[model samples]
Target chain A: MSDVIKLAHGDGGKFTNELIKNLFYRHFRNRKLEEGIDAATFSVNEGRMAFTTDSFVVKPIFFYGGDIGKLAVCGSINDLAVSGAKPLYLSASFIIEEGFPIDKLEAIVRSMGDTCTRAGVNIITGDTKVVEKGSVDGIFINTSGVGIIESNYKMKTIESGDQIIVTGTIGEHGTAIAIQRYDIKVKGNFKSDCNPLNGITENIQDLYPYIKIMKDPTRGGLVTILNELAELAGLGVRLIEEKIPVSREVKAMNEMLGLDPLYMACEGRMVLVVNKLYAEKVLNRIRSLEGCKDANIIGNFDQEASLKVYIENYLGGKRILNTLEGAMLPRIC
Target chain B: MSDVIKLAHGDGGKFTNELIKNLFYRHFRNRKLEEGIDAATFSVNEGRMAFTTDSFVVKPIFFYGGDIGKLAVCGSINDLAVSGAKPLYLSASFIIEEGFPIDKLEAIVRSMGDTCTRAGVNIITGDTKVVEKGSVDGIFINTSGVGIIESNYKMKTIESGDQIIVTGTIGEHGTAIAIQRYDIKVKGNFKSDCNPLNGITENIQDLYPYIKIMKDPTRGGLVTILNELAELAGLGVRLIEEKIPVSREVKAMNEMLGLDPLYMACEGRMVLVVNKLYAEKVLNRIRSLEGCKDANIIGNFDQEASLKVYIENYLGGKRILNTLEGAMLPRIC
Candidate 1:
């Protein structure tokens, strides 16, 4: 009824009900959600399922490629996707500052609805709360999702010749956020790669037998995930520096900012470890998918070396890559 | 390693891993959680399941009876409990402000762990993010939970003469929050009724055949829920003013503050609609449980009256009760 949110909107009374019906219900309409009062009920077959959650507090709410609402949906979806499950349902919770514009809230909810529709996931249950102004910057969202695991998919142990493949060029999301956060002006077009990766996961569902592990290179980026995998598997990762794909725009921007693209974040990229025999096939399959033309087998695991990760230059020089040691960028995801 | 949270702790790298291992993993440890990398995966039988989520931003994070952490767990658990489901697993996500003391965070996490253990639910997966100081108040948590629906439970339609019952005294939680928030100095003891209601749900679970519906009188309180049920069921609620149970402390606090206990909140109470034939039995069962000694049959549905909710005084004077329309409390949870 008001132009902006009020304390009464979060009082769990008349205004809260009005907001849910006029805004959330209008956008996130689904059978399960319509019947839900306290909780959404649905039937699931007997199987293994994945559950995960993430809270989005990205500054500036709106960004080059997507807003916090889209990020919230994609972030949780990606988490379930990487865990070898097909995401099914999501629960969205919001904490908004009093006086936040109603139009902006509607826009964010619209984006979330659109994203979930594209990913074929339903937001089954949700909650909203309005804190006093200044208690929160503007708004924060938390999305928790559940997904059914593919019956054929199983995590395999890493072997001596396992190869690591990155689904796309790295660091687009981190660069986009940094540019906006630091008030840096950019010349050419640049945006975050903030799309859902469930499409890639679905396409590669048949290759689960060859996949040892899969992870989204999100907040910690490419190098960090490689370091984690190397340590987890107790093997060394030998990467070909030139083989890792990097977009020209992201590379130029990171160079100007004195940052490493390898350590920067990517919102919609996957790091997959596959047996050497099927690594090339997986890379080719990924490259055939949309937005994955740069997918490449950038490295391989070494059996003789200790747990470490390093990239070798074409000229024969090498540098060790550690788990991200500093706060290069905050809330990039 | 720092005394307070830093940007690096949320960077999803080494420090983040250390925080997860030393704190979250230590407190919320379980087989499913330990194996979780990006998401927690588990097996479930074929059946209907309930899913829900809530974000807790209750101010003064530490409260009279319980902390925000405990409230968050119980809030989500109660939602599922009232939905006729047995809660199974939960996901806890935190958005903390930078510079907040680590010890304070550990205390909150410990409270959450203890609450979940008592409720017989496991926190299988979680995520943590730290925002810059001043961006968020201090800390906010979102918990999403899933539960298995009991096969025999069915929501019977509310009919004429259906009885209304409340499982505890009303308004204790809202009164406690008001006192702490307004810095009221009172002589007698006062504490929030913030316990989980799963025990009560389990105790009366065998009477599913005669139960019409169940709802937690949380933020909007008893009067608001009655109004909603009357409108939804196309019947009138005839409440006997003297029959509604109220604690002496809450009654005195509301009277002093010029607030009506009927419209105040309760964190650990359930309002049940049951067939007249079984209402007395259900009330007796509820009264036998822990913390439910105040259970009472407060009213009954009127078939001849129009859809409305009203209270009848001892002199037979009637007053219409409406859904809560004003902002009486914020973040009462």
Candidate 2:
């Protein structure tokens, strides 16, 4: 394939078909994705539940480790997962710019189909619109997902003495995208933490039903999510800076960019607030997963304050962590 | 307000509130919208039906007479309505660029709510993500709409001898956006035909239940839609150019741009192919609607040698109307 895209890719003709078959399907091969229908269909346990929708418009459609198609499917599935729901179906809509290489568009769609298949979700419907050159920048994807949450499992607030856990290393996704954008070279190895968290959520929820809140630290990162949890629960959060996991490469990249690692995005990670007693159990369960081998309890909820997030340094210094005023690494998700 | 946008607009704070109340809420004033909730929920008649999603990334955000927000809501709703469904719930997702004015974002959201209300649909769910500057243009909106189509209404092929009618005018949306892009001036007035068409579809469907196909010519225009219908039904479409209504202003603008009015997009207009015997009644019913005063019978389906779209020129010469290989006006939705 050429380094750049052409308009023939979005034509929905011969080139579009070949592109899907070769690049995207090869990586994201799955049974449901092979159907090649507009949408994937599957059964769900009967219930009325919340359905959410989201779109991915990240620049450089293809990033360091993941592309926009993969992001679209995984990001939407994560939203449903955090809502305490089992993602069932997904609908994708594409607004492709004219002159985008057909091969690229196919690669994106095939990757999307593969990602959804791995998540055990169906892409049941989709619409495609082609815009002329200059009107759009390459391609943008929108996905709407429907999931069923068990009526018994209602998302609740974290109480005092609850533990806060990070699924894995933070700032991988953000650092990866940033490095790609700036063309920065780092000595150490790094990979984007881009993976679906539904299976892990399912395993944990099946074991401990009292998981108070679950959030994927994406756009605003761990700092923003923790603040939201504190504000929602009307409690204070105390985090141990040392306990929170971060790769040396990610930290160095952040420092180089004069950025806060806490504000950087992570796609394959999650923050969970559970009773302190089950904190160890939750951490162990998450660690058993493929991508969450470094899961750890980094903080606990405090009853004294209304809505505050404090990070304790290794030298016994405490600093307040504020909610992100604006996006730190926008469109990282 | 400053021309350059700031981060506070998306903060969900005072500046964001002011932006909503002053700019967006002022233009799109409505009760449900004024609530300022994350989502607006409403009930609909329960049934098994079709659900679709669409996103509008129209450049310049605001065009001739309409904006991206209005198009987002109306586009998805129209898709459902044309599919023989009663438009119901909608979900809107936004990807706002960092530094975008909060006022602009709020204006888009409020317009979406107002447009949904006018179309008799509810905004049930939504999502917001902010990207860093340079990642995306101003703003992009993704809307997923769920609608209930009566079990009795089947969207199948139209039989031979079915009469095809177009509501109001064609090419208005495309012409308006093009003129704005090129800064072209016309003596006669030209307005974007960006009104919602649920009412017109409802009235025409009520009058002629045998309406075989209904589609709003938005991106590919009327010619592409006719070609699709003809190909699907294995028939030919014959159109009379003299009967197809085109505003004088749009004609002049098309001439100036060297664009074909037949291939130009129309946001508010729809093409309906009905049984020949009920064609007049359907035409009368559409003409009685507020925005469909100029509805007329402009074509018919024929069992010809090939599934082609033939247009009868004003001088009585016949020419083949082909599908647009590329978008006429990018992001004109």
Candidate 3:
């Protein structure tokens, strides 16, 4: 009932009940959640299910394009989507600092609700914990999701000539957060690319057979995932430096900040490894999807056993791309 | 590779990979987890499933009996167990403050792995994030669990004559944490009653037909849960004070601290609402299990339309037991 959160709100008493009933229940209402006392029960068919969890602790709760709420929902949803599963139910747990404004909390909850609705997923069960002032920065959210895996989708084996394609331009999210965190005044529209990728993934369902693996480049961005893929496949990556998609604004901002776009994060983009035979078709299909106008074939797995990732320029100069080493940016989710 | 966790460890790059492979993978080794990339995929039968989540920010990460790792796993397991489900899989996410010692994190992870191994559940997928030093106190853990609901168990409707039973003694957990937090000098083996309740729940499966509902009295303890059940069933609760189970040490600690045992928390206990005809049988069955010697039928739903909870002493003295109000103990979990 207070304007800001109190320690009593997490005491599992009247205040806790009020907060749950008024804010969480009111926003995340569903049949399973309403009937649930301790856990939400639902029926699942005989099939494979995907489960994943992520926590968002970005420095500024509200950012240029999205807030922590949207990021939390999209992060988990994207994980399941990239794993070839249709996102279904999610559990949200929050650790809130005492004295946080009720309005701010409501706004965050509203954002999560809106995103879930847009993504066609439900927040079935959740828990809330409030700590003393200064114990936590402001609020941190952890979302775990369950999704039913499609039977037709299976990760194909990677080969020497497998092509790598990116769904969109890189580094928008990390650049926006970096600018905001450093309080650097920028001119152009520099906002996070934090959108749900389920739409794009579902649209490219027909290409599942030709796709070896798909990953959402979130933290440690494009180059980091490329390194992971190269290591996993026991092969080397050959990137055409000019083929990598980077928006002009993101490129300029990274130049100004002296940060590599390759290591920066992206919230709503996918990196897909496709069979060489269908690589062009997959690129065309992804480019037709909304928000994927810049889709392109960035590189291909080399036939070498080096187990390294590198970029080659037009003049044939090659440079190794290492996995992100130390902390480039903290709390840049 | 340092003595303490660095922001780079959460960067989702080389250091993050090393942390996962060396620490997380080594402890939480399972087929599904080892094969998982973005999400863990598993098969499920055609049945109802239970899902739950909890975040543990308990102060004094290491308590008299257990640490935060054990608490986090047990808290989520108990939630699913009380819902008449067999706990199966869990996802763990951690938010650690920079400068926290690596050995402590490993100890916590080892405790979690040990608990999950004992409870027969798997930590299939997880995420780790490290914030700036002052952003968080030390560490916080969030665990979300999924379990399959047993086909034979169904929640029967509550009636006025239903009986209420507790599986073990109350207030041990809260009392133990209070003593540790406030540094109260007492001459007794004061420790938290933090243990997984699945063992007891599984042992009492034969009595599921007569069980109306089950709840773990974790935060607000027995009285708070009684109030909730009374409100839900639209009936009053008449608790027999002498019939309730309380450990001698817990009683002594509460008396010295001037805290009400009725409002204290218990971690490894269950408050079951059962049919009156089988209440005695349920009590006997629970008493025969491990660590449940104190099981007793403490109260029964009153044959009144008034929705309230009260206690009746042996002398016929009665007092209303309202839901807990305000902050009693912060971060007691």
Model 1: per-residue Cα lDDT over A1-333, one tens digit each: 899999899988889889998999889989888785899988999999999999998877898998999999999999999999999999999999999999999999999999999999999999999999899989999999999996487778888789999999899888889999998988877888888999999999988899999999988788898888888888999999899999899899999999889988888899999999999899999999999999999999997667888889999998988775777888775
Task: Kindly list the per-residue Cα lDDT of model 3 for residues B172-249, writing each as its tens digit.
Answer: 888889999998887888888899999988888888999999999988888889898898888999999999998788
The numbered model that scores best in lDDT is 3
lDDT of each: 0.90, 0.74, 0.90
Q: Name the docking class for model 1.
A: high
**Regarding lDDT, does 1 or 3 come out ahead?**
3
TM-score of every model versus the real structure: 0.98, 0.84, 0.98
RMSD of 3: 1.2
**lDDT (tens digit, per residue) of candidate 2 on B1-333:** 544355544433334455556765565555544644322323333355556777676767887767999888888888777776677667777767767776676667777767877888776666665555754667878888766665355555688889999988888988888888887665566778887777776765565467777788876678877887887789999999988999888887788789988888888998988889989988888888898888889989988827999998878999999876555655665
Q: What lDDT does candidate 3 reach at residue A108?
A: 91
Candidate 3: which stretches are off by over 4 Å?
Answer: none
Q: Among these predicted structures, which one has the highest DockQ?
A: 3
If candidate 2 were superposed on the true structure by all CA atoms, what would the RMSD be? Answer: 4.5
lDDT of 1 by residue, B145-261 (tens): 999997467777788899999998888888888888889999776888898888988878789888989999888789888888888889999999889999888898999998888
Q: On residues A227-270, what C-alpha lDDT tens digit does candidate 2 reach at each position?
A: 86787788998999999999888888889898888988888888
* TM-score of candidate 2 chain B vs. the reference: 0.88
The order of the candidates by DockQ, greatest first, is 3, 1, 2
